[model samples]
Target chain A: MELTIKQKKKIRRAAIFTALLLFVLVWLLPVFGALLTSFRTMDDLMNNGFWRMPEKITFKNFGTAWSEGRLNRYLLNSFIITIPSLIGTLALSSMVGFALAKYKFKGNMALYLMFVAGMLIPFQILLIPVFKLSNELGIYNSYWGLIMIHLVFQMGFCSFFLRNYMITIPDELSEAARIDGASEFRIFYQIYLPLSKPALAALGTLEFTWIFNDYIWALVLLRDDKLKPVTAGLATLKGNFITSWSVLVAGAILATLPTIFVFIFLQKYFIKGLTMGSGK
Target chain B: MKRKFVPWMFLLLPLILYTIWVIAPTIYTFYLSFTEWDGLTSPQFIGLENYKYLFDDPTFYKSLINNLKWLIIFLAFPVVVGLFLAMLLSQDIKWARGFKASIYSPMILAPVVIGLIWSWIYQPQGGLLNNTLTYIGLKSLTRGWLSNPETALYAVIGAAVWRHTGYVMLLFLAGLTSISPTVIEASKIDGASAWQRFRFIILPLLKPTTVIVIVITMIQSLRAFDFVSMMTRGGPFNSTNVLAFYMYSEAFRNYNMGYGAAIAVILFLIMFVFIALYLRQIRKGELE
Candidate 1:
């Protein structure tokens, strides 16, 4: 039977709509279920299904997670590691990127390629060596070790990102500054730094979330319970609360908030930063 | 003298720091791969023993195969699903932004958080996934999703696909936006069906984005560690172990630094090959 054009179009439209709705439900189910679980009591979770409504909503789980789980300490540790890593990556990568982008030097392209190659190398490849080196240098289990690893790993991508952005900044700006008697350092500080704020902010936000959420590195390098960040901390929480579903949900939700906040606040720049390498 | 000093001065700090921290360690890692040292013992020349061990170890092979599985599955699911969603959402749909955000929110959560959340969902007895299965009257389908060796690795991959499809969708969305509206309009005016428009116009135009997505996904999937560690700890007799997690276990947990270094080198070579191939493809695309 030959179908009319209008009928075919209508069928296609309905099929597409159904597919979209089904995909949306699949995406949202776990998140919504987790949210609902976070608000229920352990008794409620044990007695009722995760999807079921509780007799009353409660904030006790969040309170327990915050205090007993020592999330405040982990949050502080995350910031301590994240901030320096951010500053170090941005500062080193920008300077290196500026030199590569602006000045003609021997092995400039070679160095740039080195960073690009480094980006492709998985962190696992670097893990054992880094851990050994950190231990040998007496920085293992210390915040410094974690920060250094993050800086080194981040340098490759940051330089790659900043170089691409810096290339578009035009050589004329730097040359004009040089003609006006601005030293290179002075120009980097006074001109380039100011102009690169948006890019820096974008990269910084993304990197902060990454470093804060880093688990494998922290697990390998930082052995002391006191030094572990929220990600690794939550893993410990999982171990302790293995049977307590409500507490686990609470811990997971708490761990997710900082990254969510960063995303919500820097939503626009975060998207741009994430897609930076893809476009080029 | 001032001019000469200025260049060197500007280069001093970064070069010195990066060399000490980055370049030196990389070279050292290679050298360490040939030595027998466990972070406490004196370094002794071991030749190729570590590499030989890596080749023979069942765990390493399991990891390598699992890594391959992850790469293939991760590459297919996100791109195919993401492209489909992006195309669908590209239509003049209500609440498209909300839909996009709901999909993308998981990507923003830390992988550890994702791992934890999914582990709960994959719980054998009373977890969300099993409960839903039982709720819908398919009680027999409910099983130990992450505990059983057969489904452990795939279960983690499912979690990853859930987290990443939106990210890949965003990339496709951006690629879709850059496609000229005039081309799409002209195709429509030719009485091209939706399938024809997608096949003849959209797909041809989306090649660059697809390349980017594939390369990124391949790289990420190969390096996947957190999910494996958190969800399975490569457990149920080393079922879900991937190269990254295996490398971690060897070095940190087992104190086999040299062996771990060997695994790392292998992983590096695998990634290098993929990246080199991708760069060549990108160069070819540019020429075209």
Candidate 2:
């Protein structure tokens, strides 16, 4: 039987919808399992398993994790590291990016390429040297040490991002400001910096999430328990709550919340950043 | 006078921090790779002795092979799924936004969290996968996934793909959205099949994006660390060891800084070639 146009469209739409539904379910199952497991009590978890819905949904695991687990401290370290690193990176990268993007000068390509190549190296290679260097700088096991590492490493990608971003802003605005009495720094401070807010905020969100979720860096650098970021702190959770699956899952969920909020709320900016950062 | 130095002044902070923390350390790693040190005391230069040791180490071959396996699996699975999903999502559909967000949510989680979640699911006894297998009467298939050398790496790769595929889809979707609708419409009017139209018109246009997906996935696979380290720690006779983990274990755990640095330098060279090729591509594009 020859299919009518409406029928064919309907069939195709059904297929598309089914495929998308299946993909989303498959992708989200592990996430849902973790969330479901977090809500369950250990008793239920031991008896019924992680796949089943909780017999009694409870938030006590979150309470225990926050207080007894000292997740609060880890979350605090996350902010201490993420905030200054964010501000410094944004400030430094945009300044450097503005220079590279707008200026025509000698060594421009080389300088820009240096930043680009800096990003391409496997950062783990720098682990030994960076560890030793931080120790020498007398900042080992300190919050500032991790912050400095985050800032320097992120500069490459951030500069590259801001430079590319700043390029797209019509050169006219900066040129007009240059023609005026405004200094180049003033132009950047007043004009280009404000204009690049969207890129800045997006990169800031990504940078925050990244440094927050950093495992190896925190594991290597921070020796003090109080200074451990949430990611490193979560690894420690496994040792304390070896049998308490619920508490560990709850902690993981807590560790994930800020990034999740940033992701869902500032999704467009996040996607834009990801797309712009496609090749890396 | 301030204006004369303002740009350089701006360059100063980033340059100082970056050079001291990043550039110098990177270059020093090369020299350190030749010398024996425990991250302390005086260094004794041994000159390719570390690399020679790495070459003869059987575990090095195992880890290298696993990395290649990971690279191959990632290149195949995530790229294909991402492209298909990107195409699927780009089509006008109800709740596409919701579906897109749902699919991409995993990307927001820490790799450790992803690893933790999957590890539970893959548990051999009373775990999600084994339970489901028993329910479906595939009870014979159930085994300790992380402890099983043969299945361990592939199982970890599956988790990596789960996180990566969504990221890949998002990139492809961004690229797909920019294509002119007229090109698609014109092909449709010419009685071309969907596959034919995609092959002829869409694929070529997506060259830039395809380059991105290939390059990024390759780099990600090569740099695979957190998932493997968190989930398996290169266990079950080091079957799942990748260069990054092996390098990390050597440096921090064993204090074989020189050997680890050597491993890292080799990994760097492999990645640098790709980075150079990518840079060349960008320069060519600029000329166009």
Candidate 3:
């Protein structure tokens, strides 16, 4: 039977909307269920189904999680590790990116490809050597160790990303600044850096989330409890509370909050940063 | 010509750090793979011995096979399913932004949190999955998900898939946006059915996205460590051990640094092969 264009349009729209809604539910069910479980009491968890509404909500889990889990200390450690790593990665990447993007030099493509290859090399492959080197340098189990490694590992991709972005800005802007008696460094700081704020914001959010979510590096480099980030702290909590469902759930929720909060609040920049490296 | 040394100066800090932390370690790993050193002992060149032992080791073979399985099965979760969702949501739909945000939220959480949450859901008797099955009178279908040797690897992969599908979807969504809307409208005006439109127009347009998804997923699968370490620790008799976790256990836990370095070299070779292939493909695509 021949269908009118209006009927076909309506049908297509309905089918697409229904499928999207179903997909959304499938994607959200696990996250929502986990969030609910975080609020559930051990009694409620054991006696009732995960889908069932709780009899009463409890703030004690969050309280216990914050104190006993030592999440406060872990939060500080995470900030110390992530904030410096973010700043260091951004600053270094931008400086390197500016040079690579703007300057005509020998082996420029080779240098860029080296960074690209570095991005593809797995952290597992680097584990033993990096660990040994860290120990040899007397920086093992220290905050400096974590920060330095994060900066080194992240430098390649960060520089590659920023370089690609920096190339897109009109050369005339930097050239104009240079013609007005600006030094190369001055052009980078006063002209390029100011115009690159949006890109920096985007990369900053991406780097923050990546550094905050890093676990293996922390697990290997940090052995001291005082220096462990939230990921490692949460993993320790899981090991200690192996059978305590409420505490474990609470810890997971607390551990995830910072990243989730960053993503939700700065979602525009986060998404932009993620796709930025992909466009080229 | 006016500033020949300026760019070189800019390259100084990054180059030094990369040489020390990256290139040097890579070369050192290659050397250590051939020596009998345990981080403290004097190195003795053991030539081919570590490689021979790895080939003969059953656990090593199991880990390799499990890694392959992860690469295969994990690809479907993120790439295929994510593409399907992206295609569905790309059409004009209500609450599309909300749907996208909900789906992508899981990717933002730390792997440790995702691992812990899923571990609870997959708990044997009183957990969310088992409880749901029992409540619906399908108790026989439910079993120890993460603990059972038969299902342990697959169970962890399921959790990983759940966490990553949103990420893949985001990539596809971006790809979808870049596609010219006029092409889709033209197909519709040509009286093409929905399936026809997708099969002929949309799917072909998404080749670049597919390539990106494949490369990223392959790398991610190769780096599969955190979830396995957190969830099962390659337990139930090493049923779920991947190369990453296996290498960690060998190096840190067992102190077999030489053998671990050998394993690390093998993993690096495998990844290097894929990356080489990906770069080649991208180059070919560019040429075309």
Candidate 4:
């Protein structure tokens, strides 16, 4: 069958569309099912199966999860943990990054490499010791305990990212500010920080998602259930609410919403953060 | 001298925190690996006993093998899917932007959420996969996918691939975008077929991106944990257990801190190899 070139092109386009659509389905199927399960009652999900269109949908599951599943408590805890950690990481890293990127000093390169390598080490190596350390410090099972751990671990990646970003800014800007009789802190505050806003926003988005999604560290450091972030709290839900699929699914959806919203609205920054942080 | 002191002032706090929290704990773990310790008491020094036990442990071997399986599958599956999708989506097609958005939406999600979503889909009784199969008249083909030892690791890897393929696609798209359109047009004018153009030119030029993808995927698979933790907890007779999850269970669940630290050291070394390669590549570029 000698098809014309245009006909062959049409066939190729059709095949491409089919493949793309198939992958879309593959990616969305689980999420779509979770959404469906979240809306339907547990009885209906059990009897009618996930394949069936829900005969009725209710917002009651969200309410139940919020109340009974302790999602409200967990969501509140996630915010409490994520915000300060974000501020501390960004603040502390930028200072160190500024020093390393902007100065010629003893051990600057060594210090920077140490921070970078700290990020790549399998953190599981430090788990037992950090756990014991946190306990000895009397902050174990408390918010500050986890916050300190987050600060230290995240300082590595943040400093690496920010130092790389800060390096690209011209040294002339800082010099010019210095010529104006600005203090070193003034130059940083006015020149470097202002110029680095885009990178800051990008790193902020990336760091927020990371600190929000942290599970293992939170599980290891924080012992009390009330102090648990949504990640660990949702995990506890998984154990107890084994049969309560609707409420459980609702809790998962709730836990995922903040990051999902960040991704949807701040998507450009998120992508920029990812590619930039990868050292491209 | 004052100016140099100024830099140190800026560096002091970060360095202090990093040492106390990150470096000290890292050193302590290495020291603790040689000692037997529960949480309550002083660590008792026992030279290489935990490492010796890890050598004899069958579960450790199984977990290592499962991690190897993850590395192989991850390197091949997600990279191919990413390249394939990036090529298809970058073409002049309607709704390509929307298609990419839908495809990449999962990548932003937490692995726990993804695992929970897949759990519902893969649940045995009247779950999505089983029901869909039954609807299409493949009644006998459906089984407990996550419960079966042979298929359990694979089922979880399938979930991971779904979440990560978009990430691969995005990186490849960036690489593809940087490639010159003029060169492609010239190739076409020279009577090169599409396959020939892609094979000879495009793939060859994408070597750097391919290297990055390969190393990242390998490291990630070695560090795979969230799925086993969320979905199966490395169950079905420890079928889906990998090094990361096994390390967690031993340390936290069984309180075998010394043994778990040894496993962590192994995982760290494996990761270090890939990270070293990546860092060297980045550093190599820095010199130029």
Candidate 5:
């Protein structure tokens, strides 16, 4: 059974293709199971088990998850917290980034290292202190507290990312703006910010997903059920409906929509932002 | 003086917010670790007592071992699988785009969502896993995966690995793109075997990406709190406990803020070692 060289190559290609298909199917099975479970009635799930085809499909779970589960209010709280955190984080970090990138002042390198190091530290250390601080400031259990913590804690990564990005912009534009007596703030706003659009867009998309998917911070700071964001709120729903697999799965799926949409539509920016500093 | 002051002006607000929120709290947590405060009282300084109790605690040892297990599994499974997937996709294969998208989609979902999905799959009585096993005549193998003490941590780690493999693959894909094709072609023309080319050329070139992957995975293992909290809550007699989740339970559930702070300090130190190594790598890369 002597095979031609081209035949050998075709066989190899087909083997690799089959391997990839198998891997993807296994990788996606959990998600598929969840989806299947989401549409089945409690009776169907109980009778058929999770691996079996549903006896009857239902849309009532999504409706129950939305209203009775209070997912509608939680979704609104998520938006309120995530949007402000995203905008404030970018705004503050871009300023610090501009200064560090464009200027060579005393403690410049030290400040940059501080941010890079701070961003990497496990945040569990700050849990108790942050909880108390929020309480003292009278912002505990409010959207403002979670928003502020997110804004500050996220600044380190955002600043480090933006500074690395802004460093690549030509210095001559800022130099010319400086010569024409443009204020530092004006120069940043007018020239550098606009020039850094691609970086901002990429970072904005990444930050949105991270902020929206936040559970730990919201769990710690927001005790009021009405104030919890979608992720934390979903956990409560899980607790309430532990026996009701369909409703719990429905809430989980609903909570996942925003980030999934971001990943699908703005995938290019998301990958670019994530892989920015890692690759050459 | 005016020129010098302008940069500070730009940095002022962020610096203020960062210091107040992040730096000060971190420093205070260090101080709190030394005191006997219930988070409500003025602290009584009881230096070294928390550390003393922690040193003898069985659960701490269990958690440390579990965390090490997580680190070992992540370093082995996801890194290898991710690199393999990236290598296959880098070929001129059809439907590569579709495969990449489907694999990477899990990374976008909230950990809560991922936890819920896997919870259903690992559910004891009518779980996907148990049902499939029974159907295939392996009924003896089926057990309550998440409820069994021996299997709980590994079961949760499997879910985490599922969510993380695509991220590692994407980074490697980026690293693969940066490699010059002429280098691979040159090896092929010289009659290099595929394995030989990978060993000699591709592996050496991918060092930076590998370092990044290893560091991120190590840190992620330390931060494996979310899934543990979501899936098992360190249950089945605390068999699945990790350092981060232990710290949370100690601080909030028991109101043992001081003891929790000490545990947090330990986690921070372990993670700090990796962060330092990563930063050094970044610095060397910048120099080059």
Candidate 6:
């Protein structure tokens, strides 16, 4: 008995579905463990172990993690750090991106290459130098210092991405605006900026997540616990809450919520930004 | 005149910031590599001394070798698996968005969170991994995966690969989406087998994406500090030390700023090769 083409296609689809289902489950096992463990009490983990289901679920960890673990403050710091950095990055990068995309000048490619390559430059080299520079500049251990670094350092990647994106925007629009006697800055503000919203929104989400989750910069640059962003703060919680698995894991989850939220909300733009920059 | 000047007006602030924070520091790192500085005092000139010391340091060699190991494994595993997953998801499969969201969720989590999550999984006693091993009656295979020197680096690498696969998949999915469907349909009408079509058509067309993926992966492997720092801190006797972590520990922990700068210089030089290739690719269009 030969199977019909539709039947064969159906069978093949089912097979692919099952295979993907199995693979995704395996891939997500660690996350599932963290999520499950976050809901259980320490006693439950101690008695049942990390592999088993919780005997009694608890939600107190979230409350305690927020108030006691100092995650609330850290989360606030993350927002404080990320929002300004995001705004600054967008403003600076968009301008540079526009300049690089719209202008014809000596050292244009050189400037563009500098930004792109700077994005990929190893941070290890900048670690000590930036730390020293920050201290020398009287901005050490301050939110502004970290915010400044994030904005400046991220400008390279953001400008690079936005430049690639802006290049695809037809030149005729800008040229038409120029012939209308509009000033360059006015044309940028009115026309190019509006057109660049998708790219800006994409870069905004990416930069927000990156600056919010940054651990290395926050660790070396800031000294005060109150100044630490969620990533660095949660790491400190890991050490301080050595015996409390629930609170630590809860804090970890809480720390990721903002970025996760941004990712979910701006997912379309996020992926678009990523694919756009990859030379698609 | 006004046209040329207008672009510079836009470029001024970013250029100043980039030069100060990125370019100057990069140049200073190279200069610092040739001197001895404790980071508190002035750096004293000692040309090539740090490099000579790095050449003779066993830990440096270990870290270099470990970085190579990381690069090789990353290229082999995540890139391959990501491409496979991308291809699978690209076939008009059901619930592709849900699956993609699930797979790509880990990439959004901070390295600290990922580190802690994997620690729970790799914990020797009552940890998920060991318990699963024991549940299936392979208790002998279960041991302290992270505490053991032999498995520490590999174990950390395993966790990193988990976080990285989704990113690679996202990249490949983008690449796959841009591929024109007419070409594939034509090949299929000619009775090309799935394997033949992929090999002869899809693979050849995906060269640009492949270049980007390989370069990005290589650079990422070189920057493999976060997971190592979060999980092991180059521990079990520095068995997991990559160059980035080693440099951090040396400069920050031990106050060997000059030595750390030298290590950074070396890492930068290694990354420069891939960066150059990537730039060459981008330059082909020349912002047209």
Poorest 10 consecutive residues by lDDT, candidate 3 chain A:
A271-280
What lDDT tens digits, residue by residue, belong to model 6 across residues B1-288?
A: 666688899988788888888889999999999999998889999999999999999999999999999999999999999999999999889999999988888888888788887877788875779878987889999999999999999999998998888888999999888899999999999999999999999999998899999999999999988899888999898899999999999999999999999999999999999999999888875644
Find the candidate with the highest DockQ and give its number.
6
Query: Model 3's lDDT to the true fold?
Result: 0.86
Q: Model 6, A13-101: lDDT tens per residue?
A: 99999999999998888878778878998888878776666798889988888988899999999999888998988899999999998
Best by the lDDT measure: 5
Pull out the clashing pairs in model 3: none
> In model 6, which regions exceed 4 Å deviation?
none
Q: List the residue pairs that clash in candidate 6.
A: none
Whichever of 2 and 3 has more lDDT, that candidate is 3
A137-201, model 1: which lDDT tens digit per residue? Answer: 99999999999988878888788778767767877888898899887899888887788888888
Please rank every candidate by TM-score, starting with the best: 5, 6, 2, 3, 4, 1
Who is ahead in DockQ, 2 or 6? 6
Name the lDDT value of residue A250 in candidate 3.
84
How does each model score on lDDT?
0.83, 0.85, 0.86, 0.85, 0.90, 0.89
Cα lDDT tens digits for candidate 5, B245-283: 999999988889999999999998899999888888867
In candidate 4, list every pair of residues with a backbone clash: none
Docking class of 5: medium
| TM-score per candidate for chain A alone | 0.92, 0.95, 0.95, 0.94, 0.96, 0.96
Report the lDDT tens digits of candidate 2 across residue range A199-242.
89878878777777778888788899999988888878867886
The predicted structure with the larger DockQ, 3 or 6, is 6
Off by over 4 Å in 1: A1-18, B1-11, B281-288
Predictions' DockQ, in order: 0.59, 0.65, 0.71, 0.67, 0.76, 0.77
Q: Which stretches of candidate 5 lie over 4 Å from their true place?
A: A277-280
> Cα-based RMSD of the predictions, in order?
2.6, 1.7, 1.8, 1.9, 1.3, 1.4
Error of 1 at B198 (Å): 2.3
